[model samples]
Target: MVDTMALLLPFGRASRTTSPSAQHPAAGLPADDEVLLDAPDDRLGPALVAAGQGSHRAAADLLAATRALGRWDHRDRYVLRLAAFARSRPEWVQTWYAAAPDDPDVLLLRAQLAVDHAWGSPARAELLRGVSPLITAAARADDRDPVPWRLALDHARGSRAGHTYFGELWEAAVRRAPLHYGCHVAALRYLASSWHGSHRECLDFADRAAQDAPADSLVQALPARAALAYLNDGCGPGVPPERLHAA
Candidate 1:
């Protein structure tokens, strides 16, 4: 949901490279943990520090600001980081929930955490189904946000949802933000799931989405991600070497 799964290096791995300046130039150096996706924001640094000290107020305020500004991109990244943090140190998030159960931002965070937790379960589909209400609550909380729809798309895939239902969700997601990277990637994954072993169709979908998206869009990377998936999976006639090279 954050980015392609292949792109998620271990948390501290990127910081080990010596060329931090080349990787991410900063007016001031950010802490190792603060470095994310090779681009660290000034706001997330202090927000993370606040979270580390067992406070959710800063995290809440940061998300609220992003939401108030309709900064969906910033909201997506913050949700991923906050959910990751909450998974390990849950007390702060639990406190936040206790204090403001109806808060839209809090609901979004909780929904992400819930789905993430469900993903590891043996009864994944059943668990995912149970969490539908959380996803719905988050979606209803803010109609302008596509991140919840991204979450819903992931949930639909996990729950083995029918194509019509999945397509409906996809429509709603893209309508909110036509080129949202998270939603596009989610749709790609759904396509891959729905048409198992049809690598060509999946790759075509990825390529079209990437081409239609902006040059800087993460959707541009979807084709490469599709190629990787085909290579990793040996169930079908693997994508040709030339295709992989092209990707």
Candidate 2:
């Protein structure tokens, strides 16, 4: 886990001695013109454009490369962006699936799209349950990939599965990639939702996870997330300022 205090000590000391504008320019707020919302990276830009033109080859190739290299974080992000694109213009995804129905990348994207679609419906639990097979197939498609397991964790949560079932999914997720941020987040959300009003339990789980993860792992951010959730919940006991700062 990251030493949060160690990481923040320098900044904490600096805050007392320096003004905000005196900090490095790179650390300062960017100009309004500099901000670009939902901008795709260079590689993703081309794929998104091609998809807009009703082509899925570039997107497929991009996801395949990410998966082949075991870049799970990039794969997760790409799958989400691609799935969002499919929601608006689905022909490309359909064409890709028809061309290669067994492609793991497409399978994952399809599962994500299905879940996203189900989330907005009134019968979310029923719809989510119906999408279980898609998530299962995606998980089965790649034993070493943790993204599908993340989706499974989310599916289990939306479907209101029991603690034992959620735990089984959580185990499968961490077994694939213990430090994967998305899987950890999915687990955290499940804990927060399934065990409503159990703020202490959620914080403890987040703290333990952060302690076990590497300093540079995104899991290091879990405690801060837990703190945010607790604060937003309004039903929990008050968290001390020091503990919140440490998080």
Candidate 3:
């Protein structure tokens, strides 16, 4: 509602390495405590931006201050911030989408947020219907770069065929061991749902992670979850992915 589009460039310009704890006043809060405790070289810039746009006044100001830096150095600040706001603040999404309905990135961000925040709310597919093409175009524009696996995961939830469709990607991504290594949960869910539904693969991932995962551990507790899923699905006193990988 506040003409955040023009601010996109500034968002892009700010360094992603800033300390959100220092930038966000609520960094010390429980949920944000992680952001405050860890002063990583790269902060969750996108999440911070969204927090700012949503209600985190400190996040907003930090985003604004990031603008003072030159544009040439800007990253995906607006995109990240818009995404963050859409997640915690759906009202912001409705408002921004109304003003710039055709903005693909905005629509995609909303789609991702819808699913992430869907637990207590409505099903998120409809939100995707209106913006599907926009998201497709943005993906094309970015040369099929991954927007957010949540978008793919949304489709994966719709049908058995959908599971098969994304299975290969999930497998390949796991092998690549990406940046947000933690997000593998989205992919793991899809993989576990596929026809083959090999719990071993996820187990392998967890095991490998145990061996090579960062000190901050992405899916540390994941092995147990995978084991439970295996048992629930009647996999026979199944071996947890972590243990299987471990052994």
TM-score of each: 0.80, 0.81, 0.47
lDDT of 1: 0.75
Considering summed lDDT, which 10 consecutive residues are worst modelled in model 3?
1-10
Q: Write the per-residue lDDT of candidate 2 for residues 96-183, one digit (tens) a residue.
A: 9999999999999999999989988999988998898999899889889999988987787788777767777777777788778887
Model number with the top TM-score = 2
Candidate 3 at 15: error in angstroms?
26
Q: Can you tell me which runs of candidate 3 are displaced by over 4 Å? A: 1-89, 100-105, 113-147, 162-164, 171-177, 193-201, 209-212, 217-221, 228-237, 240-247
Residue-wise C-alpha lDDT for candidate 1, range 7-56, written one tens digit per residue = 11111211111222355446688644444443346887666667667899
Superposed model 1: Cα runs more than 4 Å off: 1-40, 193-197
Q: In lDDT terms, how accurate is model 3?
A: 0.43
> Residue-wise lDDT of candidate 3 within 145-211, one digit each (tens)?
3443334544444333354456544543333334333335554554462433566665555445445
Compared with the true structure, all predictions reach lDDT values of 0.75, 0.75, 0.43
Q: In model 1, where is the ten-residue run with the lowest total lDDT? A: 8-17
Candidate 2's displacement at residue 110, Å, is: 0.3
Worst 10 residues of 2 by lDDT: 8-17
Q: Which is superior by lDDT, 1 or 2?
A: 2
Clashes of 3: 7
Residue 184 displacement (Å), model 3: 1.0
